[model samples]
Target: MDSIDEVLGELPLPPYVTAEDVGFAVKALAVHAAEQWPDGPRCRNDRAPHPCRLHRWGQRVLDQRGLTDRQVQVLIAEQQAPQR
Candidate 1:
């Protein structure tokens, strides 16, 4: 099976990264977050290996935004956290 990253590589980039692109990136991250598996926290969104396309895309966008790993983690946490 091809990894999501591989598929992502095949994807063509849009003319430019816009706000809509950011939204898609966020969705990708949330959808492709790791899941707790019997073996380990594998990618739940896609069965095609860990760090799926969406996940990678999200991380890339976050990176472009100048976020560190810790910062991305916090952002993701906030997204998943309960909205009060």
Candidate 2:
């Protein structure tokens, strides 16, 4: 069985990385985070494989923006925090 990613292919990156794109990417990473399953890790949001299309796309966006792993983590943390 082909994975959803294989069927749909990768999501396209932005033509130019912008602050808004970075914010969307951060949200994607947070929402598409992995969860442990009896079979294996899978996407928490879609039940697809872990590192699903959106997750990979988010990583690519952040990479294009030259964000470090630490910086990405911080952004994700902020994204998950409660909004005032």
Candidate 3:
């Protein structure tokens, strides 16, 4: 079956990665986290295949920012932490 991206196309990335873009990216990854199904992994939020479009877009944004895996983890952790 054609993936959502194949039908609707990918969401556009910002021309320039900014702080706000990074924040949004972090949220996207957090919200679009994967879940296991009998067949395979899928997006927790949308039930689409794992690594859904928004998840990929967020990864690309982080890649464009040259963030290390550790940094990305920290960002995700911080994103999930309770706010004061």
Candidate 4:
């Protein structure tokens, strides 16, 4: 873990995972997707370590909602698609 991560700590999770929460989670995961860096992979959004706080929170929410890895990928892809 990075020094900043240690200082900032992990983001809190929602008490109840709802459909809206799932949507937000999907968005979070997609927006916070990892980026390659000279040091290593980091968060594209916040530029924190890979699987940043928001990213981990999103994955946790989706896991709580019973979404599999494949399902999560699909959700991310759908979000990435251009709106017609």
Q: Per-candidate TM vs. native? A: 0.65, 0.92, 0.92, 0.90
Candidate 1 deviant stretches above 4 angstroms: 1-23, 36-41
Tens-digit lDDT track for model 4 on 10-61?
Answer: 8787888999999999999999999999999999998888988889989999
Compared with the true structure, what per-residue lDDT tens digits does model 1 show for residues 32-81?
A: 87887776666777664557666776767766766687876666677778
- For each of the candidates, the C-alpha root-mean-square deviation to the true structure, in angstroms, is 3.2, 1.5, 1.3, 1.2
**Alpha-carbon lDDT of model 1:** 0.67
Worst 10 residues of 1 by lDDT: 1-10
lDDT of 3 by residue, 27-50 (tens): 999999999999899899998888
Q: C-alpha displacement of 22 in model 1, angstroms?
A: 4.5
Error of 2 at 23 (Å): 0.4
- Deviation in angstroms for 16 in model 1? 6.2
**In model 1, what is the error at residue 84, expressed in angstroms?**
1.9
lDDT of each: 0.67, 0.91, 0.91, 0.91
TM-score-wise, the better of 3 and 4 is 3
Which one wins on lDDT?
A: 4
In model 3, how large is the Cα lDDT of residue 6?
91
Ranking of predictions according to TM-score: 2, 3, 4, 1
List residue ranges in candidate 3 displaced over 4 A: none
